[model samples]
Target: MRQQLRRQAGAHSDHLQDVLAVQERELKRRFEAAHEDRLRAERHKFQAELAVVMGELKGVRDAITARADLDRAAHHAQEMWVACQGLKQAIRTGQLGAASWQQQLKPLRDEVAAIRQVAGEANRFVESVLTSLPEEVLERGVYTEDALRERFCKVERLCKRVNMIDDEGGSLFKYALSYLQSLLVVDAFERLPGKEQRDESISPKLNTYEIIARARYCVDKDDLLQAVRYMSLLQGEPRLVASDWVRDTRLMLEARQAADALLAHAAATGLQAL
Candidate 1:
């Protein structure tokens, strides 16, 4: 009986040990699964944060590109405006030159009229561009100093070409006078108090003889040395004092005295002879 009891107790102890082993294995498996789930959650969170960061970077890049495009457009519009203004000024100067020559030569009027027509077309084109440009561009003062200077240089070159052509066509004096007159007109017109008055009245009347004479008088008074220089260029190596005499110091003196005498005679008798 005693031996049987001892055997039963040992068997019970062995069964309890086996049950504890099984419980330990199940606990280890559950802990491993929880650790894996936590690691997976952390990885998913990292990927989501990276995606958000990339999206923000893309937005910033797009904004930068948009700003750059706006700047370029504004710059282009300002350049166009400056070019148009310069072209208008050149056309006005050309018209003045033509008018001055017309008083002395009829054919010059036709040339000037053609230039005026072309200028009108250019003006219309510029006006269209101005109208089409965004108001923001003008408000921002998009024209750079370099752009303005370049346009001015281009217009000046055109004026120079016109002057050269006029000189070649046998009207150097008239063209020079026209150039001086145009400068004065532009200055005065720009200095006017009101934009409307300048644009409507002063700007359009820049091609008149009175205007030329006024400009010449102003220039002469301002710089006598420059006036003398210009006059010397115009006279260009005096060749003859009169129909009868070749040019010399003595002949020049005699010619001056004769001119004074003729002026006096004309004043006295209101008569002149060629």
Candidate 2:
């Protein structure tokens, strides 16, 4: 009878052990599933945030990509500025992540690094274009392209003031001829290329009004060299008035060219060639 009791107790013990083992396995499985679910949620969030950040980064990329033409750089400055702002926001968002969160984002390490590198390159390019100059490339410093344009306008206005008080003094007969010439300038005296549009009513040579208009048109067309050429044709006070402006415009052009080379290099090298 005692032997029978011992066997029964042993059998019951084994059964209990088996049940406990099965329960432990079930508990482990549940815990694992919970952990995986949590991880998946976190991954989804990271992916969403990463997508937004990448979109912002791509905006900057697109603008730079569209900047293949050097003259178009000035045109796209505002676009670049806006994209850079978006990138700045994205970087700040990334930096706001906690240390523990950063570890959780380990899978995104490469992507985050890539964003940082591109952002760094973009910032350098934008600063170089908007405020700084490649003195090594251009051998000179310059104002921002926008500032150069503003300066030119102010200088043009100052030069035009010379016309408002024009005093071409000469003999009475010469003055009479000049008055007749003035009358001939009922409209601006334009010596445009292609063919002569001259008539009795139009002056054969460019008047001050025509010179200013032509130079302005050249500038509008991003033809700084031609603008300078037009301005150089001025005589007397207008020439003196425009001399400094012309010099600065030339400098701006050189600096702009240097910036263009830098931009092209950056583009050619996948925008990583800062």
Cα lDDT over the full model 1 = 0.39
In the range 1-108, model 2's lDDT, one tens digit per residue, is 999999999999999999999999999999999999999999999999999999999998887786555445543443443444433333223233335322211122
- Sum up the clashes in candidate 2: 0
Give the poorly placed runs of model 2, Cα more than 4 Å off: 1-140, 163-205, 269-274
At residue 186, candidate 2 shows an lDDT of 30
- lDDT of each candidate versus the true structure: 0.39, 0.56
In the predicted model 1, the residue pairs found to clash are none
| Top candidate by lDDT | 2
Best by TM-score: 2
* True lDDT of residue 90, candidate 2: 32
Model 1 spans > 4 angstroms off:
1-32, 95-274
